[model samples]
Target: MSQAADRLALGRIGESVRREDATPKVTGEFAYGSDLSAPGMLWGRTLRSPHAHARIVAVDVAAAVALPGVHAVLLHGDVPGAKAYGLEFPDQPVLAGDRVRYYGEPVAIVAADGPERARRAVAAIRVEYELLEPVVDPARATEQPPLHPDRPTMRHGYREDPRPNVIRHLVIRHGDPDVVGDVSVTGVYELAGQDQAFLGPESGLAVPDGEGGVDVYVATQWLHVDRAQVAPCLGLEPEQVRIHLAGVGGAFGGREDLSMQIHAAMLALYTGRPVRMVYDREESFVGHVHRHPARLEYEHRATREGKLVCVRARIVLDGGAYASSSTAVIANSTAFAVGPYRVDNALLDGTVVYTNNPPSGAMRGFGAPQVCFAAEAQMDRLAAALGIDPVELRLLNALAPGDRLPTGQLLTGSLPTAEVIRRAAALPVPAPEPLPRDPLRLPGGAGNTTHGDGIRRGVGFAVGFKNICFSEGFDDSCAARVVLRADGRAEIHCAAADVGQGSASVILQVARTELGTDDVVLAPATTASVGSAGSTSASRMTWMAAGAVRDACREALAERERTGGADVDVEHVFRHPQTLPLDPETGQVTGARAHVALAVAAMRVVVEVDVDLGLARVVWVGVAQDVGKAINPRSVEGQIEGGIAQGLGHALMEELVVRDGRILNASFTDYLIPTALDMPPVTIDLVEEPEPDAPYGVKGVGEPPTVVSTAAVTSALRDATGLLLARVPVRPEDVALGSR
Candidate 1:
């Protein structure tokens, strides 16, 4: 091919093209939301409740208002319009007025000339509270008095339980509820709350437009959703609130909810000056929702021949305080209760209840990670009881096309469960390194704690799947506008937040491929520029953005052809196949499907444990993921690697210690995450099975790795320890002591 032709194909589909922001990010030239500022900007700070649950007797902001640099001291009553806001349910208070439901709930806001002054003003505000007993346990949340009694009872068109503090209770009775297997294995598992821990804290700059409107430059997942939720609270029309996506350092699902967006906008509008709000490290921990800590009791049954029979599970998720996306989280937990397997019968009860714990909502895998850990552990137990290999057992019952989920949603998309399992299993395992070689490579790296004493190596495998797009009748769609310049370059406009998952690169690649040009530019993501590209979550950005960009490019090309090679601009909205809501009573799909697509992943984790010290180190991870298609092979690999790192944290050391609804370890010094030294070498096999219904046969790839990697790591830990470790963030003491 000529050099010209090669240049045109530089970033087409299937190529490992460089990320658009890679250079800027690596060179330290990238500006995140925290870097946002404007002329005459005042720093905004929030005053949070110290108690978990408390009735506000009175809020005195006189001292705060009299503070030297304080410009505004506002309470809930000062809210221009709505007093409450949330992602799915408007139950969380914009500012706690009558009461505070959870610890760190915002009760008042302060704006000052500087960040220090704002902090001082916040400290000066006095709040008199009447302490109340917090509903700290999800299992007994319903028995407690109502936390949100006046909130609506309906969610996603399903009536919630009338019981107090019950967010959503989903029951799935598939096949025979009374079916019995020749052999059964039961176990109880617990998952601790995990934080998104994105590098950039929640921050935003709200500049009031002179015309009774505001422009919010913030780090958020969805610009349109932010506008939708912020406008009502500001007593402004939707058009009056414009949201622009600032550079996001990372948002595994943390930016999906309101943090400082509304508060900053309110301060900006009230003061008529740019208001900048940024959560410090400590405040960031309390400002956002975490992964729902769960308790799962699972029983897996199988025949003596190693074929699966039935699965029975009771899953309870602690959706702390308010309903952010707890209803949908519970739905996912129930739908995927039985991993990526075909079971003849299943009886699953999944409930997410209100608690005084930190609010739990979208985190990487949503609710699938918690359930996958439990289900995979039960699968291992069943395998042990049936005297079968874990990989063989998984392969025997791996979900295939045409198989129906527990929710009765047929697998019409690409779900290469068995293939991924086989591929992951076939990957060559790393040979054990010679002992007394490098202390840095051991379980307690560089600690010089041991000289390879009591070291044991173990290997384990896990396979899991997750739904691709938003499910349960959400109008999942993306819009893109393509303008073909007379110079033959193309500009693609879509409001899809990148969130550090390389969606911008994917969009650029798709536009270049469709328009047959390498010179393509991406417009800044903003609500004012284009229609909603939905949220940069649920692993849906690539699929949705690609479809929208592809359609828009094609339309623009056709217009150009019609105009005899003149410049053309076209806009198009691409909608996924419609999904139906699940039946509230039976937990069955109301129509052909309840999810847009499904992706599967299989992982084999190898670990070395110091049995005496209770320390563990992951040596290797082999993953086979059902990507449907790889838009950028390198970017896909990065996603897989990043997900494995997060999963490793969950399996080994990422524990958000919450004691009675208070986060004990909110800082990085106490809450550990996987660093470069802790990460293992990852081997990946991308399974490209085309989903017939998807554009370019692509499925979302961000979530499946996280869904299964935690399970795989824990399986390895159990293999080495010979212990029934039922909980995650496996403490060193549990391994060192249990072994004795």
Candidate 2:
């Protein structure tokens, strides 16, 4: 054994190997959570309140119990140990108790022979409600009573507050805010609520043992957390309740928290039969959390020469009814408010309010996407005021390899803002042409409402970054157990959920690369073997799970190199370096707490807008991104393309329509997403500058495209209309109003 073979190890680190799971996924043989079935499993359904906010006066489950197929009906009183649970705070009720916060909030569950019977039985169950005032606006949360008490109305933990709807507050004060600049631009931006829109709805199966314990087969991001929450709710020990990872369609941070696991387990334990729960499209929208809707008031000051001077921002986030990661989300939104730029003076205040909107938690971009739209927009506005190129303005403030973030954490990794932007801007813009008279590709879209009208085109530039893995001092680690069999094969065991990010395949690739063996299998992720892989979020699993796999494989290889002489297999965990907590006053970190994936993106959008009908159609889009190290350059480009499509949807078409605290348009039919025909011809420019800190210097590649593309598309629209469309999902009326 010599250094030559060791160089082979380094060779495998950066090459793009074929994804192990690709064939089955493309062939449609891939099984998702909805595809799971078991013998003698009863279908579970939950009854929800029709009212947005109401008091639970009384409940009558006798009718549902009398139904022939109905085996069990469980109420709030049936919860075993904990009545409320949340990812960040214990504010959300597992079952509706004295009050219901939002419409569609689960109140009771029914287990029956089939899904239809369960639905019927759920309909038969009657619950009397005393309708209450619903606090629909976040601006009013401070003046309104919270659905979940601000303090000890339920469980008290590390921190408690005697307050109203405010769940958490994060204020970052950096350089003196009193510093004045030669020129400044002030504006406010609004971001609407965005849904995860994962292709698969929520589905799971829970089998209760006759001995008062249960086992759950569910679609989730973290199996351990699901086990923890369900064990307490079902009145069982953690050891008694085992969780197996079911097939996932896509998570994108939506499935990070508990969904139907508690309800299914509770029903199964009470009914003594395996219960299966599958949410319909509307129910899925109601069952899971959405991204936070925000109102950001931002002011940016810069020298006339384009050097960033100071930044002041006030970000108010609507947490909806319960505190679900709202505290951490506010910290994320406010702390990164200045974006991947260097600002000397900064003063920021972020407050999350508990209103009767649908509770918002983790989405793909987390909190950073919201502020990026504001911060990047400010940069564009400032560039216009100073007559500097938008790209040049950003490059002037672009953080370098050793710059300090507004949070005061040193930017240790690649901060290629200028690099990414310059290359992205150099991308070839699409050729423009006059609007066609053809009826099909008209401005009103498939509806064929407008054939020809006033049309304009515009281009925009944007830069954004999201933390790659978990931060804020959380013990974010992954466990990979690589078992070497006598037959010269390997098996990788870990609970890293594959929610369409290709983490499963990536994990296998990492193992293959490290072990230098092609014969390897990634055992299905289950709580039975591996520890928590955190959530398939923050675009972390690719690096986190891959890191774990490589570590375990490397250990096995090391052991073989020492004793087995080249055929040894072992298992181990790969934990990232620990992060330090952020300082309260200056928002500076006393230690290493910041981790990010930054991508500077630019898009040239051509559109045909009917000023009369206020309908616009995007003609084409061009993009460029820095992926650090494209482990799979092809796959990375695909992800960037798909992310841009979703971002375009957010800019021009996608929004969750909530009224009176109820999600109105919950289905794809009503809530429009982009289709293939809706997607314009996309051209992508890829850059490779490996992140030194990342595994193999591979930067996280999932969320950065999503973070920047939305603002770029919206910026183009603003350029065309000459009117600032401050809000997203720009409506048709907005264009018509601008035409006036």
Candidate 3:
């Protein structure tokens, strides 16, 4: 083979190639956004509200402005442009002007010469507030006073609902709503708010260009969206504000909403000097939006043969103070309420309400995990009532190609629901250990909490699916520019955030595979360099980026051939098939589809529980996922394992304890996440069924594991204790007290 051919074979698609930043990240040489700095840069800090709901009586920043080394102190009146900005709705104030809706809402900002000086200046600022009762309960939100009385009606997709404190309300009616089956089960499940808990906190550096323009280097999921939201608040043209993607630690949808980007830029522009802002661990918890806490009530009906007949569900999600992506999140929750089962008659209602709780937005699993827990639990109950195996019941009702979902959108993509179910069920179960085993293998590892005296073993299975890309008529597209130099090296430019999910490596691999050469490099992601690649949430980056890069590479190659192989530069915009918004009344798609594609996964978990002590330990987990294709097998496996760890955390011990809209556990010391020792042995099986419309037939691999594993773990717990276990992060008190 020629030298070029050898190089082409080095890191082609489907190979387990190493990540480009793996060594730097592991060696602590990586520079995250929090490491950003500049000469003579001032530190920025925010003064937050201590009350969940209160009316601002007066603002007093005179002391803060007079403090030594304080460069600038800004209030809401100082905002030159728009006062509010959000991902979906412009409701959240950049700085609270009149009323504070949630605890920790930014009330003022300060920039000083040092971190300590900034903190001292922020402490000097004082604002008088008139305390008001907060609306903290989602169930009673509609009955309370309107949070935004000026905008009593909120629009979701093509529909609008005129309800107080409601962000979005959607209803899905399909087939006959009165249909009933021989066997039925009903259950109510609840899930607490979960934090993204990314290692790097919200940080950014902003520098003034001395030309009424500013450059912002920040950790975020979408650069274009950030620029779009930031420019208006600064009273500058969109082109005047340039957003450069800084090194991100992790963003499982946490960075999708604005954190410190606007505040840092505002301070820098106001002071006419560079400004750097970094949040500590406690502030980081309150800075970013968390996953929506949900209340799901589901009823599943089946015939004597265990085939799903109908599903009726009511899902209420607490969207918190502002509408980040609550409209879309509620749509996802309502659309996929029945899990991956085939149900002919369905009636679903999903409502996301504004409350005094912390704002909730995107997470790893979007809105699917909350409903999956309830749907799967109901499935198990139906199986028990009908005397059928759990896995067998799921396989019988698994969604097949050409089947219609509850939204009436046909499943045309590669959805191997049954394939994954069977594969997961076929995996070998872990061998049972004898009593009085090693202390480290007990329920509470290294804690010596149990001696295996009251241990009970159990196994459980669950399946779930979610939409791949932005749905409900959102125009989703990605643009890439590829330049092939005369020296036979190529450079690919695309504004797709890596977000620690390894999309940078996937882009490089796709460029190499399509160009048939390994001499490719990725340019830094920035708003000035490339067009929108959309947000990194919704598990769409791999599919969107691969398509954009492949098209751009092929176009560059064609241009080079036409120019006698001198040099070529080309850009291409790749878009999926257009989807339509759901009908307001019927909740059915007006066009052929309402979603771009679908991905499904299944998992089986083995758990050992101590009934007396109310503790549980997951021994093994088996996962089977439909990946369409693995652009990089190693990265895919890593994503699956990481997602499972998060799911396990939510299932067993992760919750942001909030009382009366005040977060109790705002730091890692109180809020728990899964460590290496807490993770079980996860066996992953990739079902590569190439999607017809996707480039290389690759489906997203991040969300499915998270969507199903939580339900599977909870199922195992129920089996062990013979309890309903309708809530997540099952507390020891609940288990020991036998309370649902």
Candidate 4:
């Protein structure tokens, strides 16, 4: 074909194509980060603080050093340059120093011949500690002393009150606060702590480069950030600590913070041998950060006609013991406190407090999911009190194009909250049949308790929306290189972590259509080829990476057209629009780089609750999300289906139970996530609205199902039991006792 014809026939942004990673993932052949291993690599382990809050009185590393096969033991004294480091704040010690604030806080590390030897070495080390009072609750954080004095309430680090336990404080004010309405709904919502429950625990290998530097291979989200954090503690230059992402099992924001990176690197550098560290299931909970548990107080005032007039919210997130992404999480939680609705006046004050609990940081939903549950549930309550159809009421307040968010950032592109919710609600409802005296498909599903006797049914809907890309303008971006090879295939080089979201597949599908090649090879992502694609959180990778990959492909095609070549490769970067910092005092206008990517809104859950047993079964979960354009319709469906399943688990069965700041259910057997047998077949309605700015018009599909599913299930439980059901994974006693 002629160059002109080929250029004209190139796939535009909305076509469908095959994903490159589909085969490997499904066949169980893909190697996750934990699967990575090195020859003669030593295993590593960490000795943690038994007391949640304690002062380090003394440490005797001699016992551990004397142990056979123990190669190295490292601690804060071993740290070369920076004593503390964090994603946004340099408040958390890489290894605990003068004091330990959480039970899982690492004070010492050990590397040996095997994971068992490393574990035993840790037991041998004697550490003297003076116990301090543990602050377990975020609400009680302000009254107590702070965990770190360096971090304060405001953006000006120097101006903050030297109080304990307040890492980040954010306030957002929008419009005239003078606006008020007579009818209002005020309530406090409590969100429990969540674990990523990522199947593979943290694993990494630090291979010395024969220089003073080391090449660290690990499963992580941000390659650059990990390097930046690890290098400072190791007292090495940033370039010296080369971070390579290994095959990740599933991060879900758990791997966002450093787990085994620096420890393994330090050991490898000291021993002059490759060192590897992998966390056991129990160790995984202590090894990584969990999702912040939140307490939110929401006051919503609306006109009698259901027009949102004013909103006042105070959100307190439990940033357990460290300042890991606490600043960003607080900003997001407060900024979107009113949800994706049109509120004329909003006073949102959010606080992230340090507590001697398990460390919490970025999760898939960032700070938005916790707020979404409260906001949407409040919407339901408002609808009930005002006698408005919940669907119609939501549509009235849904933020459309050109809407100004609570953060004062204008919502751009296809803001389809109204369309998405409507489509989801329009799905045909399932009719329940009168089961015979014998019951096979009841709540317990073939279990003897599956009897239909005490079952009560209710359908509930929740409309949830989240900002797609990283907000507040940190210049968060991604880089991708697309090479159309002579083998009649296209290859995408991007370091965007998939985290089991199939971003690699999505990128391949985008490439296949763009270059019109069926055989698409997605090169294993590495920092060598692509620039930092940022973390896979915030649902941005699909949009940002695809934009870069497609742009590079287009550039390659243009170059090939001019040079008359069949194969061409090009690379490009996709940066999100920039955002500004929030004004400290008045919470007035601050420049924000907020752009709406693709809103994959979802509505879920019809359920039957046996109020007697506090046992509830989801009858079905119906989801509606705008994929903008499905590059691969099948994969798009997979994302929605998978996200809903995860959300279902969060709503009904998943939580990391922490007692006295210690994770009680770290293993899968104790801390239950959903199995296929646990989930109902999710009914999905694909709402296709082509996003003008995205490549192939594809909207983000991984997060919205998760965003909306929890609320829907919780809402359904409320309807079934006629109880408030304020918390998730509803307890049987609550249903049986008819507790509110």
lDDT of 2 by residue, 114-141 (tens): 9888889999988899999999988877
Stretches of model 2 off by over 4 angstroms after superposition = 1-28, 150-163, 434-442, 561-569, 596-604
Error of 4 at 354 (Å): 0.9
Q: Distance (Å) between predicted and true CA of 16, model 3?
A: 0.6
- Candidate 3 structure quality by residue, lDDT tens digits, 298-348: 988889999989999999999999989888898999999999988899999
Per-candidate TM-score against the hidden true structure: 0.98, 0.94, 0.98, 0.93
Candidate 1 local lDDT, 258-286, one digit each (tens):
99999999999999999999999999999
Alpha-carbon deviation at 74 in model 2, angstroms = 0.2
Better of 1 and 4 by TM-score: 1
lDDT for each candidate structure: 0.90, 0.78, 0.91, 0.77
